[model samples]
Target: MPQVFEFKLPDLGEGLTEAEIVRWLVEVGDVVAIDQPVVEVETAKAMVEVPCPYGGVVTARFGEEGTELPVGAPLLTVAVGSEGALGPVGLVDSGSGSGSGSGAEAGSVVSAVGSGAGSGGAGSGSGSGEAEASGNVLVGYGTGAPVARRRRVRPEAMAVPAAAHVTAAAAVSAAVPDAVQGPVAVVSPLVRKLARQHDLDLRQLAGSGPDGLILRADVESAIRALTEGAAAATPTSASVPESVSAVQPSRPSVAQPAASSAVERIPLRGVRGAVADKLARSRREIPDATCWVDADATELMAARSAMNSAGGPAAGPKVSVLALLARICTAALARFPELNSTVDLEAREIVRLPEVHLGFAAQTERGLVVPVVRDAQARNAESIGAEIARLTEAARTGRLTPAELTGGTFTLNNYGVFGVDGSTPIINHPEAAMLGVGRIVPKPWVHEGELAVRQVVQLSLTFDHRVCDGGTAGGFLRYVADCVEQPAVLLRTL
Candidate 1:
C-alpha cells in the first residue's frame, strides 16, 4: 500500500491568503516528481506555479481550474509509495460504441520521462530508482528546475473498448457510488456542472472530444435539443424520433428564462479585485496631495543618447529613458529621505526606510502590476534597467511571484506609455509617495534664455500629507525636474 500524502497550498508571501486556479499542469493518475509545479495559481499579488512537495502518483485534485482556494486548503493527494496507480476508468454511455474511449487501467503505471514510462513499470517519475521528498525548495515555490514532462500512458491500453470498464464501473458504482462517478469521460468541472444543471444522463451521450471526452459544446448541444423539442410541442403534445430523442436530455428546467437579464456581471475576484481593494484602502487612509511641474526633458534625452552611444560599437545595452529616470528618482530620494518613509499608524510614528525598493508600474494583459526593483539605490542606471526589463517581461508573462510585486518604498508610474499627459495616480498602500511621469513630447519652452521647441515632460508627485508638509514633497519634485532639465545636475550627487 502506498502512503498517501496530502499537500495543501503553501503560504504565498506578502500576506496573500488565497489563490485562484489558473490551470492544472497535471491530471489524476499522472506521475509527478517532488518540487514539480502541478498547478498554476493567480494570487492577489501575482501569478504563481505551485509545486508539489511529495513525489508520487497524483491521485486526486481538490479544486478545478477557476476555483479559488484559501491558504492551507488541500491542493492534491499523492500516493507516495504505490507500486502502481489506478488509471482513470474509461466511460461510455449506451450510445452504440460510437464515442466510447479507453483510458489506462488501475494496474498500469504511467511514466513521466521519455518513452520509457509509457511501459507502465512500477516506481516511475522519481528520476532516481524510488520516490523521495523535495529539498531546497523556496517556501511555497521551487527553484526553477527543468520543466516536467507530461506522463504517457500505454498504447495498448487505449486500444481496448471503453464499454468493458463502463459495465464494470456501473456494477462497482452500485455499491460504492461516492468513490466512483465512472470517471464519466468528462474532464472539465464546468461541463459536469452543465450536465448536472439539466439533470442530463451523461452515460447516454457520446462525447465529441478525443477518446470520447465530453466537451462543453457537446453538452450544450444536448441542452439545445431538449429545449427546441420542448418548445416545438406543448407540454400536452408532440415527440422526437426514437433515434434523435434517445440522446436528447431528459431535464429541461435550466433551458432559458422568460425574460432576458441583460446585465453582465463580472466577478471582481482576481487581479482586478486586488487592485480595487488596494486603491480603496489607499484612498481612505492616506491624506494625499498632488503637485505638478513641467520640465524641459531635451537635455535628459540627449544625455541618454550620448550614454548609449559612448562606447563606440560595443557600448552594451542602451540605457532606457525609464531607467535613467529611475536613477534620478533614487538620487532625489537621497536628497529628501522623508519621501522614502512610511507611517506606522499603529505606533503613531513615521519610519524612514534606509534602502529604496523602487516599484514601476507596468501594464500587462492580466492587469496593471508593479514589479519592484530591489535596492534601486545600490544599482546604477544599467543595472536598474536590466532588472526593470526582466521584471517587466515576467509581469507580462504572468510569472512574477508575490514577493517581486511587494515591498516597495516608492513607486514610479510612467503613464506616458499610454500617450497621456498626466494622472493623479493613487499611492500604493503602505508606501508614502508615488512619482507620475507624463509623455515627453516636443513642446515650445523657454530654454537658454530664449523660447524654443524642446522635448518636454510633465512630472507630478503625489505624497501622503500625513508623512510630510508640502515643502519636502515640492523639494523632491523640484530636484527631479532639475535633473531632467539639466542632466549635469546629477553629477553633484555622483
Candidate 2:
C-alpha cells in the first residue's frame, strides 16, 4: 500500500506571507521527482518556482492559477510506493482520508498493493509502515527526522449504528466522484470565489489554462457574457407606453446610468504599494530639508570619457556618470559621516552605519525600486557602474531578490534620464539623506574667470534635519559639488 504525503506552501522568505499561483508544472497521476518544480508562484517580491521535496505520483492539487494562498496552505498531495498498491483506494482524498477505520482500511489496501515491490526497495520498511521521503529541504520540508506516532484502532470503536455508517458512506461516496471522475482543471481559489459570488456553475464553463485548467479570465468572461445577455433580453424604454414615459419625466427624471469601461483601476499592491508606504512614512516621520547647488560637470564628463577611452582590451566596464556621482557621494559621506546614518528615535541616538550600502533608484515597468550595492565605499567608479548595470537589469526583469532591494544606508537618485533638472527626493525612509542628480546639459556658466558653455548639472540633497543641522548638510553638498566641478578634487581622498 502506498502512503500519501501532503505538501503545503512553504515560506518563500523575506517576510512574504502569500503568493498567487502563476502556473502548474505537474498534473494528477503524473510521476514527479524529488526537488522537481511543481508550481510557479508570484509573491509581492518576485516570481519563484516552488520545488517538491517528495518524489511520487501526484494525487491531488489545490488552488487555481491567479489564486492567492497564504503560507502553509496545502499545495498538493503525492502517493508514494508502487503503482499497483494505489488501486481504487488511491482515488480518495489523500489529505482528509487517513483518520477513520474505514478510510484506513482503504489506505491499507493501497499500501498492500505496493508492498510487493516496496518490500525490497531501498528506504522501504515493512508493508505496515509509511514510505520514506527524500531528506531534502527545497522550501522547508525535510529539516529534521520524523517523529513516530503510534495510532491504535479498536474494533469496539468501529461499532456504530448502521444508519450512521450509511450516512457516513454516502457522504464519502458523494465526494469521491468529484475527486475521481476527473480533475476539475481549476487552480485558483479566486476564480471559484468569483463564480460563487455570481452564482455561476463552474462545471458548465470550459477552461483556458494548460490541460483545460480554469483561469480567472475565463470566470470573468463568463460573468460578462451572462450580464450582457440579461441586459439585451430585458425590456427598455421603447417598450414602455407613451403615457407612462410622459408621467415618468414629471416625477423627477431618475435615470439609470450606463456602465463605463474606459477607466482602468490597478490595485496598489506589490512593489508600487511598498514604495507608496515607505514614502508616506518618510513624510510622516522625518523633518526633511532640501538644499540644491548648480555645478559645472564639464570636467566630470570629460574625466569619464577619458577613462573609458584610455583602456584597451584589458579595460574594465565603462564608468557611468552615476557611478562617478556615487563615488563622490561616498567620499562626501566619509567627510561628513552624519549623513550616512539612520535615526533611532526611540533610543535617542543616531545610528551611524560603518559600511556604505548605497542604494540607487532605478525606474522599471514595475515602478521605482532602489537596488542596493553593498560596500559601495570600497568599490571604485568602474565597479560601481558594473554593479549598477547588473542591478538595473535584474530590476527591469523583476528578478531582484528582497535582500537586493533593502538595507541601504543612503540613496542616490539620478532623475536626469527623465530630462529633469532637479527634484527634492524623499529620503528613502530610515536613511538620513538622499542625493539627487539632475540632467547635465550645456549651459552658459562662469568658469575660471570667464563665461562659457559648460556641462552644468543641478545637485540636490534632501537630508533628515533630525540627524544633522544645516551646516553639516551644506558642507556635505559643497563637497559633492566641488567633486562635480573639479574631478581632480576627488583625488585628494582617492
Candidate 3:
C-alpha cells in the first residue's frame, strides 16, 4: 500500500486569497515527479504553474479549469512511498520541490492512505495517527507545519451564473444518445465539486446528459429532491395553495424574459479584480490632488534622436521617451523628496525614502500592470530604457513576478502611447505620486521669446496630498516639466 498525501493550493504570496484553476497539468494515475507542475492557476497577482512537492502517482485532482479555489483548498492527491522518485525540472533538494516555475517548494507531508481513502483531504490523511508535515510550498508562503482543518466550500466558489445554467440546460436537451453503460459519463469537474458541496451522492442520481452524462442539472436536481424531502418531513405549516392549482391552467408556467432586460454577468477576478481593489483602496485612503502643465518637449525629442543616432551600432539599445522621463522623475524626486514618500497613518509620520524604485504603467492584453524598475536613481537613461523594455515584454507575455510588480516608491504613466493629451490617473496604492505624460505633437509655441512650431506635450501629476502639500507637488511637476523643456537642466543632476 502507498502513502497518500494531499496537496492543497499553496498561497502564492502578496496577500492573495484565492486562485482560479486555469489548467491542469497532470491527470489521475499519471506519474508526476517531485517539483513537477501539476496545475496552472491564475491569482490576482499573476498566472503561475503550481508544482507538486511529492513525487508519486497522481490519484485525484480537484476543481475544473475556470473554478476558483480558496487558498488551502485541496488541489490534488499523490500516492507516494514508491520507488523511482523522479526529478522533473532538475535536482530536488531535500524534499523541496524546487524544479518548476520560480522553483516552488512543496511541503514534505507523508501520510499513509487506507484501502479506499486515496482522495481524502488534509484532515483525513491522519485519520488514525498524526500527519507530520512541514516546510513552504509556494514562492513565499506556506503553513511550515501540518495545519489541517475541515474545509468549508463557499457557495460562491462553485456558483454558475443563471445565464450559464440556462445555456447548459439547453445544451443537455439538444443532445440525446443511446443508453450505454460504461465509465462515469461526467464531462465537467464542476458538477462533481457542486455535488460534494451539497453532500449529494452523484452515483445515486441518474444523469440527464447525452449517454447518461452526469451534468450539473442532475446534481442540482438531486439536491433539490433531498432538500424538498427534508422540508416535507419537518411538518412545517405553510401557506395553502390548494385553490391555486385549479387556476394554474389559465396562467403561464413562467414569465417570459424581457428582451431588453437580458444581462451578462462577468466575474471580476484575476488581474481585473486586483486593479479594482487597489484603485478603490487608493481612493478611500489617500487624499490625492492632480495638477497639469503643458511643456515644450521639442528639446527632449531632439536629444533622444541624437543619442539614438550617435555611435551607430555601438550605441547599444535606443533610449525610450519613457526611460528619459523615468530618469527625470528620479532627479525630481531627489530635489522634492516629499512627493516620493508614503504616509504612516498609525504613527502619523512621513518617512522619506532614499532610493527611487520607478514604476511605469504598461497596458497588456490582460489589463493594466505597473512593472517597477528596481533602482532608477542608480541607473542612466540607457539602463532605465533597457529595463523598461524588458519589463514591458514580460508584462505582455504575462511573466512578471510579484516582486517586479510591487515595491515602487514612485510611478511614471506614459499615456502618450495611447494618443491622449492628459489624464488624472489614480495613484497606485501605497505609492505617493504618479507622473502622466501625454502624446507630444508639433504645436505653435513661444521659442526664445518668438512664436514658432515646436513639439509640445501635456504632463499631469497626481500625488497623495497627505504625503505632500500642493506646493511640494507643484515643485516636483514643474521640475519634471523644466527637464522636458530644457534637457540640459537634467544634465546638472546627471
- Report backbone clashes per prediction: 2, 10, 0
For model 2, how does the per-residue alpha-carbon lDDT over 1-494 read when each residue is reduced to its tens digit?
45567789999887788887766776645567777888878667665789888776665566654457899987876656543342221223322211221334333333333232222223233333443231110110111222132122121332223433344345445434442333345655446546654655555466778877878877777666644544555434444333222111111222333435323355565667778988999999999999999999999899889888886765767788999999999999999999999998889899999999999999976678999999999998888989999999988876788788889999999999999998998999989999999999999999889999999999999999988999999999999999998999999989
Model 3: how far is 286 from its true place, Å?
Answer: 1.2
Q: Return whichever of 1 and 2 wins on TM-score.
A: 1
Worst 10 residues of 2 by lDDT: 134-143
Task: Sort by TM-score, best first.
Answer: 1, 2, 3
Q: How do the predictions measure up, each by TM-score?
A: 0.71, 0.68, 0.67
- Backbone clash pairs for candidate 1 read 86-106, 93-203
Off by over 4 Å in 1: 82-168, 171-261
Q: Put down candidate 3 lDDT per residue, 1-494, tens digits, no spaces.
A: 23457799997888989987765776544556677788877777777789888766554455645558899988876655423211111111111111121112122212111111211121121122211232211111122222232122221322323433344234222221112111344545456446545544444456768876777766766655544444455333232122211111111223324444634354566788899999999999998999999999999999999998889575778898988999999999999999888888899888788989999999976689999999899999999999999999988877787788888999999998999998999999898899999999999999999999999999999999888789999999999999999999987997
Error of 2 at 285 (Å): 1.6
Model 2 vs. true fold: TM = 0.68
Error of 3 at 486 (Å): 1.5
- Model 3 pairs in collision: none
Checking candidate 2 for backbone clashes, the offending pairs are 1-110, 1-111, 1-112, 2-110, 2-111, 63-187, 64-187, 64-188, 85-113, 85-114
| Candidates 1 and 3 compared by TM-score, better number | 1
Q: Model 1 Cα RMSD, Å?
A: 10.2
Cα lDDT of all candidates, in order?
0.70, 0.69, 0.66
